[model samples]
Target chain A: MSTPARLQPGDTIGILGGGQLGRMLAQSAAKMGLKTHIYCPDPGSPAFDVSNTFTVAPYEDADALDRFAAAVDVVTYEFENVPGPTASRLHAKVPVRPGVRALEISQDRLFEKQYLTKASVDIAGFAEINSQEDLDQALQKFNGKGVLKTRRFGYDGKGQLMIRSSADGNGAYAALGSVPAVLEQLIAFECEVSVIVARSLDGTCVSYDIARNHHENHILKTSTVPAGVTAETLNTARRMAEQIVTGLEYVGVMGVEMFLLQEDGEERLLVNEIAPRVHNSGHWTQDACLTSQFDQHIRAVAGWPLGSAQRHSDAVMENLIGFEADEWHAALSDPNACLHLYGKSETREGRKMGHVNHIKAKALTEGET
Target chain B: MSTPARLQPGDTIGILGGGQLGRMLAQSAAKMGLKTHIYCPDPGSPAFDVSNTFTVAPYEDADALDRFAAAVDVVTYEFENVPGPTASRLHAKVPVRPGVRALEISQDRLFEKQYLTKASVDIAGFAEINSQEDLDQALQKFNGKGVLKTRRFGYDGKGQLMIRSSADGNGAYAALGSVPAVLEQLIAFECEVSVIVARSLDGTCVSYDIARNHHENHILKTSTVPAGVTAETLNTARRMAEQIVTGLEYVGVMGVEMFLLQEDGEERLLVNEIAPRVHNSGHWTQDACLTSQFDQHIRAVAGWPLGSAQRHSDAVMENLIGFEADEWHAALSDPNACLHLYGKSETREGRKMGHVNHIKAKALTEGET
Candidate 1:
């Protein structure tokens, strides 16, 4: 890789995809005196409201992609689903943070599991399934209870099927459209936790504390800080995130979601997946920590020194999905609630519309620990 | 005034001005799912980078003004110098928060002083001067030391002159460009402070803690919280701010600057001037308090309930004026510093480029108190 130049305050950052994550990234960029230009296929992208410029075009439009790459000092994306050709074309013109390899590994389950296992990272027992015979054999090996997930374009519990028994193996295979899939043995875990890590261009890495998450209908409902993890477990989680970031040569923030299994007094964590972008579980850091995840990601992408992710207070971030955002007035009425609403016009079912972070102005007590 | 409907999350806010203040205001608005439309004649405005839409036309353009008003749900301004005709034209279409009365009073020094006096607010002795003779008489009454300021269009240290003796009365009068001016008695103040207050449309008001300000060349340099004033003096300042807001029927955030005089072991506060928009001194609230001054102003103009103005930490906000912004890397390297830079392409001498709030996680100690 070539040595990319550091970004200055007046430089423009080109962001791909226009969701809430992109909107927040643009806001952080503006705070550091950098302008943002959003490129997305959606005309009503939420990020456009906070960006300096935008282009409404599909990823396959080579002319639009070339123009965007020429206009910006750096390029980044909100999600890992950017087409490989698009990422390569943009990387040819301007530096792309986090690189294309991270996206390739994250976008497909088969590649993600293989990469984690090679890195000596503990993950759920999984097998690649290319046909009905392969699915049946994997189900038998995994004790007839596994998760069959499509290799690509899966999020928020979509594009996945459950293999209950060998008798239902063919039904599960058919449900997944018989695409290339990964069968992972489902482990009953106590809770889900995530670590958000940032890596600079020169390879310096920093990690935030673990976030205890709760989900409803496969969507993140709330995240709380001081995740009730032992000191040993917390250190292990941070180390795992740092290793993944360094191994990928990432130049931005990435989230590592893990499942903690508590047997007696010993706590063990299994790497569930890796998101090569800002994740929702770190939202509590916006109010509890000194530097928000958005700020850390922007700093890493811009090649600035990473900020300290020190937690100063306890926070509980609750998502206002769909119609729940109608209570925006209630959130506004709370003295300690910091509200953030994406400028989305419609409230579709299961859609994340906004969030409110309720913060207590003190760190957790010893009793909670 | 007719009862105006409350603004919702997806509503548009029309902002009149395209400076750093407007840029910060637009960022806060976007966080609450509100869009902002910036109207300013300057093509390279700092605010245009963050706003949802912008119109680069003079405020006097009635056609553009009408369209902007029609598009936005509510209208507000970043500065008090907006022309009366432009404000009136917008007010006829949509509600303009902080109303025309607040702008009318804060725009002219003579009117501000008169309004405060009528409301029984403590202010320095002053005399309106229309001729050289008037200035001479006011200087004599003020014991030959007074500040002569233009009645309108004055900010920072501009448009003002100091009269040290009677011999230079005509010189000071001519120095003011023979414009309508006001002569204020130069009090032997111990320190300068300000109070940022917000009032909702339904008449609830809240005030942030007092800010101790320091100025260099009449430009604000830093603002430190916990202003070291007696409880009585702090209460007096809040009361004065509330009185001014109620008197003007203000519907947004207003800044009240004051001079503190320590005489005979007693503290006294005299009103210096009022700004009918977000003030520089309140910038510390962004990092030290739960609700920033910008957030409060947005909520007030949107007809939402006022949030708590409580400060949770001790903060010192220093302005990054002109070349001072060159040390941005220093701030970024600090773990506890919150840096905010306005997206200005060029740096000019004495121009405000950005600011940083270095915050301590706790309040002042008993010894400091």
Candidate 2:
């Protein structure tokens, strides 16, 4: 079937993976008068609470996927780790935005690295590891220190181990459920930053201000915009993001995480990972920018024109993790804070319960100091 | 039963009426991680699409109301015209915010006028008209010129007649179905404006910047912020709004429409009407202010502290009446315009399909010019 020229107000967009991202995506779609049909396995998926229609069934269920595909005009997923076959199945019936290639490449660490290298994007050194021996040899190449990660379904520092020395590499492959993995040379980076970029159906691309991220215990703690990166660095990051999206022929938003390294008093950026969906680091845009990352994604996937990714204010978005959300009252009372809670019932340790974007007056320019 | 000290994140807010206002309110509630159960009789209610659960039954359906009340922690209505009995029934089961008194007072034109007068608020000269003779006498008091309106369930110029002269007063009462009505002397005002005020459960009141409104064919056309009213006039308008809400002991956002009459080289403010819910004039707040009127209303009704009613930018909000929304593509393409469309299937002339808020750089201060 040929794709429609553009989605109208009442067209339904099917979303896979009903989490906070999907919930926010649904809200963004609703803002534009579009309908959302959320498909997920968990009955208590948070996105289900705010969607037009939802189906509680496993992603691998062909019958359920077929019905969902038939019901929606187009499809997108919140998480990049959608099973390849499921996306392919849906794509056969309807347009799955960001396309199947984006999912395939980002789902595997090795493929992502390879794609980045092919696209001429700078990335850390890496090597495929099938067993302990392979991991040990790759670590030697990085001077007996590297980060070992499972090639698929890994997130928030999960399914990975840090090999500080040769002794730490022993049985590392077995520890990660013996899954196929990639070992990357660990760089002592000065700081971490991410760029959220959106590509529309006609190949139009726009990037939001870079967000310097802070992590605590492997989970994002806060992301501050006006990342303080030099103008040259910012330009390079944007160029890299545009290149990556263009190379993939992608549609929708992608979060490109990078390591800002300081070498000889000059800055260098190393492409770390790609998230083919709205990134947590971009949440500040919801309150500080003309268009939010979620809204940008919905617009791009809906075949609408891209909005200006301009920031009207500087902001720091802090995640309310676990019991941290209990302080929602304090967040609400702050005059400068915009509070967002994910409506999840249980808050286990490390689970994101909500977030607060503390807005401030915009500075004169990025890296003015 | 005593209301909870404050509503928790997971608590459900039961909303009455399933129009765009309720849809926006539910979106705001969801942003704060609160669940919403929309209660509207219309099967295709727009709000129903975004809520966790909804009941489709007449307002007077005691069984459905009881079930709805039992499921939600608090109840609020998007429209002031909710049947008094329905609100009181829900109040008996759970806290009905803005309280039953707000509903009873604002439901009738005569009562609203009397309440305004009792609050020492300046309103147009008005008289109750239950018969043609009563209308004739009221018209004579206004020098044969006044607006005759039904005392209940009137909106968007409906159930009202404009008496341009004594001849236009003929069949005025009968035209309104011979219902209880109020005839008010029509002031030839220089301009129209509205103040959106929010009063928390604790009686903390805050007001947004005054919005200068323009009408076309008796329908709202646009509302511009930084309304250019003299600061003294702005102060008085806010004071009048605060007085009205305090008099009613209100616990939600209210839109207080007023006429700005120029008399003797001085600006005189006269109260026009009270909308005891989120008002269309305040839609600009969604994109320009620290806290939107919808968010403010949700916070107030949920027994939370009120947010800052501060605008970071100047905005002009224009309603997309019916076919005007067909230019949504142009609106979306404009970098400064934030478009919002209500998910209505069919559009007829004069029906409100959506709105667009065009934001500009912040001016130095309100009424600075």
Candidate 3:
């Protein structure tokens, strides 16, 4: 916790959870002359392929954490699922960017909502249920038509259930095996969007352009830039994101997802969730902006200035899920598509294999209302 | 080589050089789920750090080449200076994308000029210097202003001398130290530019927008987009570059350097040199366009369609020579700048250690052209 606010080049960056985000974060670090040591339980994680050092040990492995912490200058994590013991352990020795508090809140949806409420960030109407009886009470309060999601270890549609009616709500809760859940009335809205913002120790916060996002079965599918949001909405979205970062004293990049609710021409942004690391919606920045979220995360973690976070081109980013990644050759051959295929060997269903970014000159279209 | 054009995932790509370009090319290849085996003489070469396999023997090492060929699907190199025998030996075993013919022509400055001239591409005035008598004759013809350069292995202003007056010309021949050389009349040009065109094995060529480049001490300092040239000059540069690529049946990214000469208030392009691989000027494309030159090179060599070479942003790319790369942290912190550091551990003057690309929106400004 006592680590310096800024990191210099040649410093070792200790990263937890070697997922695709960590893989990319390590690559960006390498490009900035900073070394990365990835600590993940999987020996075969894609991040190891590009890192200078990798430790294959469980999160509870204190010996491994000690060695990893002693070896690196700073620690950051790609995922927010670190156990309390793991987070507390790492924080005791090495300075963890985004800190254990951010991790604790983000790792659990209930805690995250509580933290958001404390920060006065707006969210959709919601209720927490620790048991089926609590679920029944929430259903009674919200009229039972809601989305029920688990309290922890959930992402990309996992641990989520939708209730269409009272009977369906009861059935959904039972289907989930009565796990501790949070139920929220789904916003009957227009679009899903996200803002990738970075906060430095100096409180310098910069947000990227809004991204109009589409999800399939709760998994991110595509993100289009110059999101057809009003100027006021865009500014408000940035403000809301800045408020969240400022409240958390967050370091590195964080993605804040929001739902655009349009009712009687009154548009509102309802906070959906926060991704503690780089989000899929921001992948368009790799080719469409001056600096990518990965590069910005590297810069922030390295104590470098957050880049312009400006979009240089109108862009479309499509995720390579499942067999979609198999079209890599086809994507590479398309002179119009900038393909980013994750080095994963297998293309399992619903798995994020990679993405393709198509950047084009901004087309002059009639302004959206 | 009986390898199919459509390579499946998990294939191995053999790269012939170990420089930063090769390193970047390897990174792209790895991202596409393909393995790379770097063949470079230097053990400390950066590419070796990121590849799955590597051969530390020189290009002329027959055992190494044969083994390298045996270990991979196809072969590609990042530089033109690869000796003919080395390319021939490698080509004998695998399909060499861009082919050995490109290497043969570009490896020698004199041969490159002769090839371009023979192909009907306009080139600067030149004469071969086989003897001191020939140098004097060329000097007399020049009325005494020319650049005498060794015919081979000259880069970054090395192995070159300028002859202005009679006395300087007298000592110039001895200065070359008896190496075969060529004397070229220095043309007064308004600007220097380069066209990076990629040719697929099927003879499909796609050209990137011409970039106006600046050089310091004969080494490239910065390259900016929307080269300060007219639309007419852009077309002329592309056509001249296409002529050379077509003539050689070259595949992969080739950089054709040209002099934009203004004679009597009319602009024209003179072919100066050709680089058979990705050029530094195109580095901005990584962030400014949908597909980067390195990714394009990987696609081209893999027998894939060359990705779109469109420019969506105006970019300024500065090569970090030697200690300049040490500014990685400061550069990374610049919101507008994307720092790219080649993992070269040492710093030496004039050596291109890495580069930073600063990009901005490419909207047309109010102007009268």
Q: Tell me the TM-score of model 3.
A: 0.94
DockQ of each: 0.37, 0.36, 0.43
In model 1, residue pairs whose N, Cα or C atoms come closer than 3 Å (at least 3 residues apart or on different chains), thus clashing, are none
Q: Candidate 1 — which residues are off by over 4 angstroms?
A: A1-3, A164-170, A362-369, B1-3, B168-170, B362-369
CAPRI grade of model 2: acceptable
Total backbone clashes of model 2?
0
| Ten contiguous residues with the weakest lDDT in model 1 chain B | B360-369
Candidate 3 regions off by >4 Å? A171-174, A363-369, B363-369
Ranking by DockQ: 3, 1, 2
Better of 2 and 3 by DockQ: 3
Candidate 2 lDDT, A182-287, residue by residue in tens: 9999999999999999999999999887889999999999998788878789889999999999999999999999999999999999999999999999999999
CA shift at A42, candidate 2, in angstroms? Answer: 0.9
Better of 1 and 3 by DockQ: 3
lDDT (10s digit) by residue, model 1, range B85-194: 99988988899988998888988999999999998999999999998889988998999999999999999889998788877676788889999999999999999999
Candidate 1 lDDT score relative to the true structure: 0.89
RMSD after CA superposition, every candidate = 3.8, 3.8, 3.5
